[model samples]
Target: MSTVHKAATVSTGEDRKPDVILDYNKTKGGVDCLDQMVAAYTCKRKSNRWPMVVFSNMLDVSALNAFVLWSGINPAWNAGKTFRRRIFLEELGKALVSPLIQRRKSVPRGAASLRMLNQIRGQPSSESIPSTSTATPPTKRKRCHVCTSNRKKTSTVCPKCREYICKEHSVTITTCHKCM
Candidate 1:
């Protein structure tokens, strides 16, 4: 969540020469790209390391699904080691380059999700299951305002209000109870 942008010069493949780049170092974007590469590379690695696993996982024709379609022709083109390697390289190259070309096509995070996250961070309150007239107000659910995947696993507890927040989303400026 660091808004600090590092000005690192990287080469942009151009005919004239190299394009000097000065832009925000988006770690999230880089991580996503790396994930794709890892997935493709893992396929190749599996082929070389465990051919049987690669075959079984990829070539299960009975359950022909989206993963196989997205990943490309599964069975791994086991004509020969050289051919397989070449295909793997080619597939990897295609996988890496495709994202760059279709960069703008990525789905942007919505404002509602952000608002919900902010609400959670500011004041995390869940659905109020209605009760009888004599019943008391339901207890507020303590959960991450952002990725509401975790509830009591937060390390830093707010000093002022004692709100729990994950390390990733917790503000560095504010001192938690433990820090105090």
Candidate 2:
């Protein structure tokens, strides 16, 4: 039996490279453009916690991609490249925060509907709605742990130490006393 071997054909000059190389070059440019845009405003913070930093960087990249897509869709309203990333980021932050702030301000319709339904059923409402006041009075007023002043109204009780602390002595808006 005779063994036959097929020789590989080599392309000379212009045809030496594959057609996919051209497509790859074109696509690579787009990837480089997006990477450049993302790199322009990357979040770099020195912290012991890795999760927050990673999350923030992902958010930054997402924002950059959104901006690019928005600009592509609305050519007339497109901003110049010279536009500051800080301003864009600030606007993005405001856009995200505005809805939450509005949500907090407006009372949920479900609560009102539930109250009406309870009234129709002749059942007393479980909780009484308080009047809208700029200063929220404490549900259960107690003596301030820090100051030990019994006169001042304590708004929150510390969860950690289980001590009542007045608004003045509270470190954080949510957490009271030394637990903050």
Candidate 2 per-residue lDDT, tens place, 1-180, comes to 112213333345576754455446557887788778777777767777989888877887799878767667766552665674567677878999999999875655443465566678888755423233433444777777677545576657554334567777776654454445
Report the C-alpha displacement of residue 170, candidate 1, in angstroms. Answer: 13
For all candidates in order, the CA lDDT equals 0.46, 0.63
TM-score, cand. 1: 0.19
Estimate, for each residue in 1-180, the C-alpha lDDT of model 1 and write its tens digit: 224434433455454332232233333576565455445434333345576766654633212333345437665545446545446456656886898878844654333443455476775333221223444432555554444565545445443334455566656754343324
Top TM-score hit: 2
RMSD of each: 23.3, 14.0
Candidate 1 residue runs with Cα over 4 Å from true position = 1-52, 55-88, 95-105, 110-142, 146-180
What residue runs in model 2 are displaced by over 4 Å at the alpha carbon? 1-32, 78-81, 84-87, 103-144, 147-180
Per-candidate TM-scores read: 0.19, 0.42
- Clash statistics: count for each candidate: 0, 0
Task: State residue 157's C-alpha deviation in candidate 1, in Å.
Answer: 20
